[model samples]
Target: MIRRLTALAAAGVLGLSGASATASAAGGPPLFTDGHGLTVVSRPAWVDGNERTFVFTVRTAQVPAYSVMEGQVSGEHTIMVTLPEGYDRVATRYPVQYHLHGHPDRPNTVVNQRMFEETTVGVPLITVAPNGSGRGWYTNWRYPPAALGPQNWENFHLDQVIPFVDANLRTIARRDGRAVSGHSMGGFGAFHYAEHRPDLFAYVGSFSGGLDLLSQEQRAAVIASTQLPGSGTPTVPVESVFGPPIWPLDGGWNRESPAQHVGPLRGMGVAMYTGNGGDLTVDPLQAVVENRAWATNIVTRDHLVAAGIPHTFVDYGDGSGWAEGCTGKHAQPSCLIADMDHFVDLLMGTLTHP
Candidate 1:
């Protein structure tokens, strides 16, 4: 039978015990009434006779209702949390891992928690995946006025999501307690965000990421619509993603290039974990020896090395990530499930230890 307990009721349970539960004893707090009438409820359900059921919800709306209304402001955002089985929150103040999903992966990627919870079960932590950036790159693009629709994902996260998580949850929102990580485009965004705002994050992780596009033909290809020769083939949808390419603008492309911001990152005292899936190949060019994306990565890495940035780089190939150039069969990797699990496991370890 599944058990459901309300905030006040759960608090009564804890108060009755008098002694902090196992989880609470370990720096993890129990889901109880926050004295201010706010309720944190944890539900335990049995599925298929295995201990896979761990879900929690915060009644933020019942608290103060800080407005999920967009437009550069912060306050109360409801977050759904999944707790580890046998969790005793009163014990420990666990570390938090902010997970960002790839395109169309928001909300869904929360399922990836199984891999993480499997390892850090006893530690008690928070994993948040807020809505709004399903297709947005989490960057503040100045081109096209509203490059990614009417929504301003970058501002929304910085202003709204972060605060909600910090205020409502028993979290150590400081740099040392928070870690940021993502895959693919999310990986790109994670690194970019850390570079721009290193103070918010203690650790950063990128999986199968496309590091940079400045030096490689990938940039040209991305801007192919803008730079098409003779104008025969229709331009690619580059404008859709980054508005019109601003090659002529002095700081336009540089703003989008993670490679350009390596210097600041090196001095930020931030921890970073990055890995590439050998399965992904770079976008192939007609005459180029390697794919454009791969080329761009090399340029980015060279820049990082030159700047002496310290970071962990992992290369795990199952043939589904951004490989530069490969015409052979199964050119891209497909071990998404396994690779993702491995990468997250590695990230947890890095953040916890480093």
Candidate 2:
């Protein structure tokens, strides 16, 4: 049965509604007002035979946030949470793994579903995927101007979504019991969260993430890929994301780029994977872009190594050339599935139970 609650009631439970006596003492700005609160837009349903999934709509003060179509923010956003195989059967709480979707993909996608199904075969971890609204890039916006309110992606996920999940689910709910991973843009987000908020996740993984955002080449690629074809308008601009990308000088750019913030990952278990862009099926132009991203991952891996941070790097060999490695291109379901399985195995082995 679907369980629905009034916005006020949900806010009270989340400590965001004015009705909550604990609201003032919560130590942070409330995400919702008395009239705004999270709601279970859908009931829990089983998928792939075992996984239980729920859909939720969360109210955020950060509206007018960037949308995929450019220059827009969605106030009420949805997130999908999937429980472990035996969630209902067992009374024990399980560790949580937050999976982020790549650019242009929402929280719920066939790729994410397939990856989750294949990766959690023997592991028991609850997975959550919050929508990034297309071009949010999983980072708090700097261009559209914050004066519009806190349309920050980082705040939404770390502050509101995590709290909502913990309040409603049987989760371990701590750094030691949590991990984060993502593909492409999501990979960047996973690293960003882990670096910026090391207290939140014990493990982090990036698959084909554009880790080196400060590099001119990377910035160019970002602009190219995000541009609206034929119109030549950039959907996500460097100025909007992290100021001017003036490498070595742009404090904002350096602050958010994973390559520049490798210090925080010193003790965290990290995993990174990328393909050689050898798949003939993929467009040649896209292949170049993917290869460049893979190169960026390589640089990030080197930084981690130099920082004495232990991490796992998987180079799924080139598709066009000869190399011994996993087969799949960027966004290829097979490669993504394999990478998630490998990373989840690593996470499951290290994560502690409550």
lDDT of every predicted structure (CA atoms): 0.45, 0.68
Residues 1-354, model 1: lDDT tens digits: 112222323222223222222222133333333323334443222222333333333332221222122221222223334444443325333346665655434332334545344544444456665432334466654442222233345555655556555554455556655677665556666777777778877667665445575664445543542334322122224554455555564355567677667676664333322322222343322213223333444555677778888665544332324232322111122223343344445444433221
What's model 2's lDDT at 105?
A: 67
Model 1 C-alpha lDDT versus the unseen true structure: 0.45
Specify the highest-TM-score model's number: 2
> What residue runs in model 2 are displaced by over 4 Å at the alpha carbon?
1-51, 63-65, 68-73, 145-149, 229-238, 247-249, 279-282, 319-326
RMSD of model 1, in Å? 10.7
TM-scores vs. true structure, each candidate: 0.60, 0.79
Residue 12, model 2, lDDT: 23
lDDT (0-100) at residue 257 of candidate 1? 71
lDDT of 2 at 28: 23
Clashes of 2: 4
